[model samples]
Target: MEKKKVKNIFVEGPISAAFIGESIAKHSSNTNIGAHSIFLGQVRSDVLGENVVQSIEYTTYADMALEKMAEIREEIFAKHALTCMHIHHSLGIISAGEICLFVFTSSKRRRAAVDACTEVVERIKNELPVWGKEIFADKTHQWKENTL
Candidate 1:
């Protein structure tokens, strides 16, 4: 089976919550997934003791994010029998506790879907072109770019 069918990537500023949901729901209905799991990653208000994340401004390094996402999707489908997968991440000015990323995974069984969902999110965080900056409520700011 072709694993590339479910791969999708988008770079946008302040993406809407509804849009992300719809993206996941757009998968082919003929695909019968007995279980579907979604993970919503919210931008927290604080990071380390010296830093505060009142908002997050995410930026990408061009098409790199999409390429990495496709790789991750292929890995997920190869490892698990997933019916579909969707990943959506916001690109700018995300407020505290607002979602920065959303991951949706489906499979014929609950166990595989749950496991692949976790793995996909971890891969995205460790390998995507996306970079984020944290702006404090007090107006101070710092880049939250990961070493990965």
Candidate 2:
């Protein structure tokens, strides 16, 4: 089988509510989709030592991440009855309470959409080459570790 082209999933800065709303609105035309599941990952303000996280500066080995994501997309398509899926991750800085990652999955069934969306997010966290530098309110920073 011919391999599908890998999509560039990075968005500059934080993902916006407007952008996400538009994405959902665009899918309204797909009448075959009975259910859609979305996962939005946000930057959290967590206290670490004497400082609180203000934002996260995200970076990635894009080529590797996209390649691995393509493999993931193909695998998910094979294993699930999904109608469509979209994944977007932020690069650069995203403030606390802002969206950093968006995963949208749809299928003709609710269970498929829900299960596939969760699995895709987990794989992206574990398998993709994305990194986040947690920047504290006190101007200090720490590299984030994925709890995959």
Candidate 3:
């Protein structure tokens, strides 16, 4: 059997708006795709008792995460009639209001694209071995909990 190829989905820091716009622009040429669904995960400042979160430091086991993502990609493709799908996640410190995760899915129909995008985002959050440390304004930090 041939070895499976894994796609790298990790970005250095925050995902940029220009990059997102460019991604959408690039897909315009693909006439087969009738609909596109996009989900952008933004860092939010939350108050933890007396401390307020300033930023979040994201980290992941690259190899494991890639492997798991590949599995998710396969599953999503099998379940949805998708023309294309892309996922990008930040791997470093991301400030509040900055984009950290981007999930884009395209399909001939709107339902498939929307469903696939939502499923992929949910899987990535619950299944991937990625961790985030919430850094507070007072220099205190704590591990973030994954919530649906």
Clashes per candidate (backbone, < 3 Å):
0, 0, 0
Regarding TM-score, does 1 or 2 come out ahead? Answer: 2
- Give candidates' CA RMSD values in order: 3.5, 1.3, 1.4
lDDT of each: 0.77, 0.94, 0.95
Q: What is the lDDT of candidate 3?
A: 0.95
Off by over 4 Å in 2: 1-3
Model 2 poorest 10 in a row by lDDT: 1-10
Query: Per-candidate TM vs. native?
Result: 0.81, 0.96, 0.97
Q: Could you give candidate 1's per-residue lDDT for residues 73-136 as a string of tens digits?
A: 7778899988877777888688886777888888888998899999988888888878888898
Residue-level lDDT of model 3, residues 39-73, one tens digit each, is 99999999989999999999998999999898889
Q: Which residue pairs collide, candidate 3?
A: none
